[model samples]
Target: MDRVTVSLDELPIRDDLRGQKPYGAPQAPLPVALNVNENTHPVPPEVADDIADAVARALREINRYPDREFLALREGFAQYLGHGLDASQIWAGNGSNEVLQHVLQAFAGPGRSAFGFGPTYSMYPLLTSGVGAEWIGGTRGHAYELSPEDAAEQVERARPDVIFLCAPNNPTGTPLPLDVIEAVYDASHGIVVVDEAYQEFAPRDSPSALTLLGGRPRLAVSRTMSKAFAFAGARVGYLAADPALIDALRLVRLPYHLSALTQAAAGAALQHATTMLRMVDEIVVQRDRMSATLEALGYRPSESWTNFVLFGGVADPAATWRALYDRGVLIRDIGIPGHLRVTAGTEEETTAFLEALAEIGAR
Candidate 1:
């Protein structure tokens, strides 16, 4: 017999997460925040009032566990999607981030592998690691576009057990075409998780994987109230998948993962769906104007389908970021060597950012 002693620090941690930063962004305030891709508009007062009313009505129920099924919220969300699915087809979590984690847990890990395009959502790779799965990084076409042909080829080769496709992808803000998503879904042998966190800002024709859910048992779409609904602090995200897949998620989730207050707030937000759509239209218009402004300023901004734009191939992005910070503008420096992502804020904030950029460029 052999005996060995191991301390808490001595146990071997997962190799993929050896040097990753944990969640939470830097805490700093600036005049213009063109970072983190948050909706610039504040939640309307009427929406807030609705939330308060819902919360007040639910206060007495706080002592009991929240509806374990989250049936009411799911039904409301499914109706909002315009495509009807039973409550059994939906699941809620702390955020779409957690929903993604559940998908990874259910499908990928150990011998199984997860694949996502490079320069896609950074969290995809991070989540793959956190779930003890092999993260396969695939190449993208020019302009950070996700190529369906390339993804199909990789799917045939790597045979990943899980795949993440971010429509209107982060940082670059380019959306993958519908045909491409369909092709990838057909090609994938494992679960195809389509993350549509920014679909509200995307063009109306932008392909949504939700329509193909009937036959594609492996397909799931993750959505959040964070962006278009201006509910970042509420931390509410949901997934629409086949009822069987949703049931699998229920087995792994922690109890009461979503608070009663958050459920009430989300339910209330759904009541003013038309108002939310109007706000999204306004933000889309601002995004287009901002893109034009960037081009007019002699900086090439990537075509965007989301609420932000990515400017690539800059000479010194770190210096540029620092200069913007000094000028009371806070934009994201993606640490991708020469890339920066600027979120669309209000008109005044947008103007300030552009002016600051022009001044910085001259120096």
Candidate 2:
């Protein structure tokens, strides 16, 4: 049989999707891959063994569908988050992206719009457009900071059907204050989502948006096991909101959306939350180290509440990125004119990236 091929344009695709690029970072088999803000540490062996045992136990009943409500997993998240939350107030999906998509599906669609500060998570606009909603790119203040006053003003003026606040914003690693989240939620008449994928990496004393959930039904805080738990490959993300808001997402989610194996593995991992999060303290150390060294090397590294650092002062981002690549290290050139982002990997990996960057400067 002859192979049949056709370009995307030749098919009956959505007009808005045409010419739109997908969101992703370069994936290379380098010695040190620190582009994505992944927890580069390996999961503790004992915890991994426990997860394996749980999955094996779940495999015995693979013939039956998983729990539609995922009640136990919700309970685990509730306990982990512990802002007086309950399973009734929880919802989850394969990843944080899907959780956000469910919110968009339930709240925003054709003729409605979703708004977010510019240069935030690259997926916000993509997810919005995927649901046939308009994406409003609101602006951020200097150094990608969004103040309470400015944030509230933008939300009020845009009046979008949904809004996303990437806490400790992606790519830039700038922190998002709880006051700003409060202002945005209060100013908007629609649903507001706070993505806290990196919340575990933030200062232990720093408060989470989860604290703001009281009496605010339209506000939700989404989290992922991918970052702090070193479970990125497992694809577990969850959210906490008013029970009413949680039910709203049910309308858009597929039945038995989470698989039995996934639920089992994630539930088991949650039992070892303390062991799982020990890596976070080490990662934070490397993140601060990277900032100090980058600044010493003439790059202005931004204050990060996440597992990565976005540094400026690179004369040419592409060349610096390429130079690092050639040295068996990988980082990100997130399209900022003179900025590059690198995850705070293991101490050795972080050292490799910094050394390669210094060598490039020398040359």
Q: Highest TM-score: which candidate?
A: 2
- As for candidate 1, its clashing pairs are none
> For model 1, where is the 10-residue window of minimal lDDT?
18-27
Q: Against the true structure, candidate 1 has what lDDT?
A: 0.84
Q: Which residue runs does candidate 2 get wrong by more than 4 Å?
A: none
Model 1, TM vs. native: 0.94
lDDT of 1 at 56: 92
Each model's TM-score, in the order given? 0.94, 0.99
**Cα lDDT tens digits for candidate 2, 144-209:** 998899999988999999999999899788899899998998899999999999999999999999
